[model samples]
Target: MTSRPLRVMECAAGTPGFGAQTGLMAEQNKNIETWRRRLTFRSWHRGTKELDLLFGPFADARLADYDAPALAQYEDLLMAPDPDVYGWIVGFEPPDPAYDTLVLRDVIAFQRTRHA
Candidate 1:
């Protein structure tokens, strides 16, 4: 049995392997920023004014603080129909099991605190 040495690559700027590693990192960051911007815009423009008001402010206040999983949850919530999502958030109706998430709870809490 032969043991091969593990190569630890330095990805810092101006270091070896920097260009490729940093380029990938930069691309990932750009994609995340693009998704965040798109979600924020969508939140502010949900067909009805009610939804716009409910989600727009939430997106603005919290989107930047969300990690990858949280961001994915938000993106899933946005994919739902506005009326359904709004109903769930406002407690007018129950969310489907899949739509029920911490992200939705956070939104509900946000709206409650924001309007209270």
Candidate 2:
């Protein structure tokens, strides 16, 4: 299946949309599934336990629904140093504002919010 840019309806982040966006995403299930598989592998095997824990679970819970812009943001995040990502996740350091995006914020929230 070919990927087109994700055309999410303009809803407030995390708010439920008017059904149009959800319907559109339902149509892209194949592409989203493909991305989810690749991201799951990468997230789980990031070469560092801290990062693996932080990202793997978040990816498991969220990757399947990520739109194109969110995926692009996540790809940008994957390029950061693991140590920096770990520091941000653990609260030892804040993420560099340049790389601190909404996607990253959502990941951090997921990490902190999920219970074992």
Candidate 3:
């Protein structure tokens, strides 16, 4: 961990350049343990119990492996209304095109296995 590397990381983190995603890179660079703790809390406390179950285990299992984009997707999912997300997981509705990613697809599969 040299100053040069730290400086480079800082520069990259500062360069997201957007209205919504400005901190995306810096957030991804945060300590994994901290992120896991926060994400776990969020997953377990969703307004609906069904969503809590669906996302809690899923986040616990996958949080360590998630890249920035995957985390962003999860955050976006959290921001969405729970009923719509439930419908997506249960296949009554498709995930929004923007949220259709491997992370979400895996959760959908997990939901099927749990129900089936």
Best by lDDT: 1
Give a tens-digit lDDT track for model 1, residues 1-116: 99776543432546666546456668888888888999999999978899899999999999998877899999899889877897899999999899899999999999999989
lDDT of each: 0.87, 0.81, 0.77
TM-score of each candidate structure, all chains considered together: 0.79, 0.70, 0.68
What is the total number of backbone clashes in candidate 3?
A: 0
Candidate 1, superposed: residue stretches over 4 Å from native: 1-21
Best-matching candidate per TM-score: 1
* lDDT of model number 1: 0.87
Q: Rank candidates by TM-score, best first.
A: 1, 2, 3
Query: Ten consecutive residues with minimal summed lDDT in candidate 3?
Result: 17-26
Model 2 regions lying over 4 Å from their true place: 1-29
TM-score of 3: 0.68
lDDT of 3 by residue, 8-105 (tens): 45555645652343365456566555766787799999988989999998888778788666777777877788888899888898888877777779
Model 3 alpha-carbon miss at residue 11, Å: 16
Which pairs of residues collide in model 2? none
Off by over 4 Å in 3: 1-30
Cα deviation at 45, candidate 2, in Å, is 0.6
Model 3's lDDT to the true fold?
A: 0.77
Ten consecutive residues with minimal summed lDDT in candidate 1? 5-14
- Model 2 scores a C-alpha lDDT of 0.81
lDDT value, residue 54 of candidate 3: 93
For all candidates, the clash counts are 0, 0, 0
